[model samples]
Target: MENSAGCSVSLWQKIVSFLLVIFPILDIYSVGIKGIGIGSIILCFILIGMGIRFLTLNRSIKLNPYYGFFLYGLCISLLTVLIHNDFSITAVAIRMTYFLFYTLLIFLPSSYDFDIHFAEQIYLKIGMAAGAFLILQYFSFWGLRYNLIGLIPGLPLNYAIEDYVEWMDAYNNMYTIMFRPTSFFPEPAAFTQYMAPLLILVLFTNVGEKKKLLKAAFISIVMILSTSTNGIVFSLFIWILYFVYINHDSLKNRRFPIFLVPLFLFAIVFAILILFTDNTISDYTVQQFEGLFSKNQSSSAYLRIMRGFDIYRQLNFFENILGIGLGTYKSYYATGVLTVYDGETEYMNSLSYLFVSTGVIGVLLFIYSLFYNVPRRSMASHALAFLILLSFFSSSLFNSPTYALSYLFLLHLDSIKNSGD
Candidate 1:
C-alpha cells in the first residue's frame, strides 16, 4: 500500500510537471510584455514551487553546468544594468526570469519516473500546437489574404499592416513584411528562433516507433512553416552539416575506406538536394543569397546585418566589458528606430544582433553559458553546438532571447545523457 501510494504520487508529479512546461506560457505572455503576462506569472510560480519541492528532498544535487550558467547570466544582467543606465534594470529582470526558469527546466524533468518518456512527449505536443496555431495564422488566414493581394500584383503593401500603422502614426512609410503568426512571439522569425532548436531535439526522439516518427514529423513541419527562410534555411544547413559531421559513424553503415568514399559522396549529393529544394520554400532566404551574389535577391537582410554592425561600432569601448546597460537600445522611450545604417531593405540575422545588444564580452559569456554541458564530444554535443550556430545566423540581432528556450532544453538533454553515463 505504501509502494502504491508512492507510485501514484510519482505519476501525478510527472503529469503536473509536463503540463507546467508545455502550457503555452509564451502565448499567454505574448499578450503583454513580462510585466503584464499573467500566464508567464502562473507558470513561473508553478516552476518555482516544483524546484523548491526538489530542493527540500535533495540537499546535495551538486554543481552541474547550470551553476556556471547561472553565474554567467547573473553577471551579464548586472553589467547591463550598470553600464547602459537606460533599461538595464529591465535587462536584469529579463535575465533573472530566464535564469530562474532555465535553472528549473534543467532539473525539473528529472523529477519524474522514466517509464513514460513524458518530457519528449510534451515537447512534441508543444511543437504540434505551435505549428497548428501558426498555420491557422499564416496559410489558412494570412496565406489566403496574401494570395488575394498578390493576384492584383501591384498593391502598395510593402510593410505589415501593423508596421505601416506604426510608421504612419509617426508620419513615415517604411515597408515591412506582414509575416505569418507566431503563437507566443511577435513574428515568425522569433517563433523560428525557439522552434529551430526543437528540431535538434526532435532528432533525439524515439526513432524506433512509427507513431513517434509521425508525431515528430508533424511538429517539424509546423515549425518549418513557422520559420522564415532565414531561420528555416540556416537551421537546416547547420543541422545537415553538423549531423553529417557528428554522425559520420552512423553514416558509414560499414567499416572500410572504399565504402566510406561512396558514403561521403552520397551524403554530399543528398545534402545538395535538400538545400536546393528547401531553399526555394521561402523566397525570403533566396532573395538574401541572390542579393549578395546575384542581382535578384532582397537587400533588406543584408542591410539589417550592416545596421547591427553599426550599433556595435557606435558603442563606446567601455561598453564592451559592461553593456550600454540592458535595454539601452532606445532613448527617452520614444517610438525610435535604431537605423545607424541607411539601406533600401534591412533584415538583421541572429549573431550580429546579439553581438551589438550584449557586445563582445556579453556574446562570449552567452556562448560559454550555452554550451558548458559536454567536455567530451558526441553527436548530441555537435548538434547542440550547431543549433547555437544556426541561432546566430537566423534571428540573433532582433530576437536574441529565442535561443533561451533552446538552451535550456539542450542543457536538460545533456544532463539526461550524462546522468546515464
Candidate 2:
C-alpha cells in the first residue's frame, strides 16, 4: 500500500510538471469556455485538493517573504478601488482571482517537491516541441498556403484567425503575404515572451556547450519565424551579451576565435538571403527595426515602448502615486475617461498598466518581491530577473501565471544552487 501510494504521488507530480510545461498555451482565451482559461480552472481545482490534503495531513504551509509583498499590493489595490468608489464586483473579483492564481503558482514547486533539473529538462523538451511545431507550421503555410492552426477544431468563441495572422499591410507592404506561427499561443509575440527566459537558461546557465548551442539555435529560429520585433531584438541583445560577457572567460582560454565564427556565418547567410531571396521578410524586419526608433505617433514601436509613459504623464499627481484603481484601466481607456495618445488603442505595456492601476507603491513592492530573494553572486539569477523585467515594457503580462511560474522556478533553482554553493 505504501509503495502504491508513492507511485501515485510520483504520477501526480509528472502530471503537474507536464501541465506547467504547456501552461502558457493552455492559458490562452481560446482554450477556455469563458473568460477563465482551462489552465486556471485546472490549477484552481489542484489548489483546492492540495488545500484539503494539507488540512488532512496537518501540514504547515510554508510562506515566502514575497507573499507579504503580494498581500500588501492586494491591500493597496483594494484601497485604490475604495478611494475611487469604483466598486465593480466583476472587476474586483477578476483582480482577486489573478492574485490567487499567482499565490497558488508560488506554492506549487515546494508542495510538489519539484526537482529543478527535472523541471529544466521538461521545459527544454516542451520548447523543442513548440519549435518543431512552428517549423511544420511555417512549411505548411509556405507550401499549402494554409495555416495549420485552422485545422485545430473546436476553439472557444473568443478564438479568431485575426488573433494569429499578421496582416501584410501592418508591415507597410514589406511583404505581400505573411503568416506568423504562434504554436498554440494567441499571438507570436506571446510565444516569444514565454520562450525568452528558457532561451536565457539554455544560453547562460551551466548546460553542456554543444547542447546549449543546438537548443539556442532551434529556439532562435522560432523567434525569428515569429517575426516579432520584441523577440528578434531580445534574441539579438541576449546573443551579444552571451558573446561579450558569458563567453569572455572561455575566449581567453582558447587561442582560436571560435565564438566569432557563428556571427560570421550568420552575416553570410543574411547577405545571401538579401541577395538571392525575395527579401520580403528581411525588408519587413528592417522596417520594424527602424520603426522602433520612429517618432511617428502611429508606429507600434512608440505605442509599446513610450505611449505608456505618455499616458502616465497625463495622470493627476494623486493618481500617479496611488493609481486610479485595480482593473480600472481597461474600462477607463475604453470609455475615454483616461486621456490617451492619438494612436493608442489599449495598454500594451505591463509597466504602464501597473503604474496606472496599482500606482508607484504597488509597482515598487512587486519589483522588490521578485528580486528580494535573488542572490547577488548568481549571475544567472540576475540575468533571468533582468530579462523578465525587460519583458514587462513590451506587453501587459503583469497578471500572467506563466510569468509568475517562471519567476517562482527561478527562485527554486537559485535556492538549490545557493545550498550547493
Candidate 3:
C-alpha cells in the first residue's frame, strides 16, 4: 500500500509536469464542460495535490516570499466588499479561489522540489512547435480552427477565431487584409505573452550561443507572423535588452566580433526578403510607427489609448483613491463606464483595469507587492523583471494565474543562482 501510494504521487507529478509543458498550446481549448481554461485547470490540480499532501502526510507547506502580497490582495478584495456594502458570496468565493490558486502555484515548485528544468524544456518545445504552426499558417494551412467546436458540443471553442483583424494605414484605411495566425490562442497577442518569458529562459539556459541565436531568430519570425504590434514590439525590446544587459559578459571575448558578421548578414537578407516579397509588412510597420505622432492613430493604438482621458475622468475622488470595490469594476462600474463611452471596451490595458478595480491604493500596493517579493540576484534576473514590466504596459498579466506564476517562477529560478553565488 505504501509503495502504491508513492507511485501514485509520482505519477501525479509527472502528469502535472506534462500539463505545464503544453499549457501554452492548450490555451486554445477548454478543459471541461465549465470551460475553465487549461491554465486554471492546471492550478486546480496543483491545489488539490498540495491539499492532499498536507492533510495525509501532515506536512506543512512552506510560505512563499510573496505571501504578504497575496494577503494584501486578499485584504483589498474583502475590504472593498465591506466598504461598498454590496457583497455576493459567489463573487467573493470566486475571487478568493483565484487568489489562492495563484498563490499555491507560485509556491509549489519550491515547496515540492518540482522539476523546473523539465517544465522549461516543455515550454521551449511547445514554443518551437507553435512557431512551426504559425509558419504553416502563413502558407494558408490551419490547425485547431473551427473544428475544435465539434469536440466540445455545448461549449464551442469558436471564439478563438471569432474576431478578425486587418492591417490599416495611419488614416484608418485598410492596407492589408489577412486572418492573423493565432497559432493556439484566441488571439496573436496571447502567443506573445506566453512565449516572451520562455524565450528569455531559453536564451539564459546553458545552451550553446549559436543555438540560442537560432532559437531567437525562429521565435522572432513567428512573432512577425503574429502581426500583433504588441508581439513584435515586446519581442524586439526584450531581445535587445537581454543581450545588452544579461549577455554582455559573453560578448567580451575574441570570437565575439567574428560572430557578428553572420548575424549582420542574416538581418540584411531577412530585411531584403521582407522588403521585396512582402512589402505589405514593411508598409504596415511604417504606418504603425508613423501613427504614434500623426493626427490619427493606427487602429490598434487608437483602441488602446483613444479614450484615456475620458476613462480617467469617469473615476470620482473616492473611487480613484480607495477604489470603488474589488470585482465591482467588471460587474457594475466598468460596464456603466463602457456604456458611457459609446460601448467602448474596458481593460484596454492593465493599468487602466487596475485603476478601475483596485483604484490608486490597490495599484500601488500591487506594484509594491511584485517588487517587494522579487529576488534581486544578478543582472539577468533584473533584466527578466524588466521584461515583465515592459509587458505590463501592453496587458494585464498579473490577472492571469499562468502568466503571473510564470513570471514568479523565472524570478525564483534566478534567485537560486543568486544563492549559489
TM-score on alpha carbons, each prediction: 0.63, 0.83, 0.76
Worst 10 residues of 3 by lDDT: 162-171
User: In model 2, which runs have C-alpha deviations exceeding 4 angstroms?
Assistant: 1-9, 29-33, 53-65, 111-113, 157-176, 244-248, 258-262, 265-277, 330-337, 342-345, 375-377, 415-421
Q: Model 2 clash pairs?
A: none
What is the Å distance of residue 150 in model 3 from its true position?
14
Residue 206's lDDT within candidate 1 is 43
How displaced is residue 226 in candidate 3, in Å? 1.5
Considering TM-score, where higher is better, how would the candidates rank from best to worst? 2, 3, 1
Top candidate (TM-score): 2
Task: Encode model 3's per-residue lDDT on 1-421: one tens digit a residue.
Answer: 1121122235555556656556545544555434356556666766677677767776766654467555655676677677656555467557667666666666654424345545555667788987787666555523332221102223334233322222112112322343455666656677777777766665555344457767876777677666676666666666676556544455565555634533463465348437533666656655654554464643554445444334655777886776544455555443354343435554546666566666777677766656655666544455566666666665656556446546555645652342112
Give the worst 10-residue stretch by lDDT in candidate 1: 147-156
Off by over 4 Å in 3: 1-12, 31-35, 54-65, 83-93, 111-113, 141-155, 158-176, 207-210, 246-248, 254-281, 288-298, 305-313, 331-342, 378-380, 415-421
Error of 3 at 392 (Å): 1.9
RMSD of 3: 6.3
Give lDDT for model 2.
0.65
Model 2 residue 305 lDDT score: 76
lDDT for model 3:
0.56
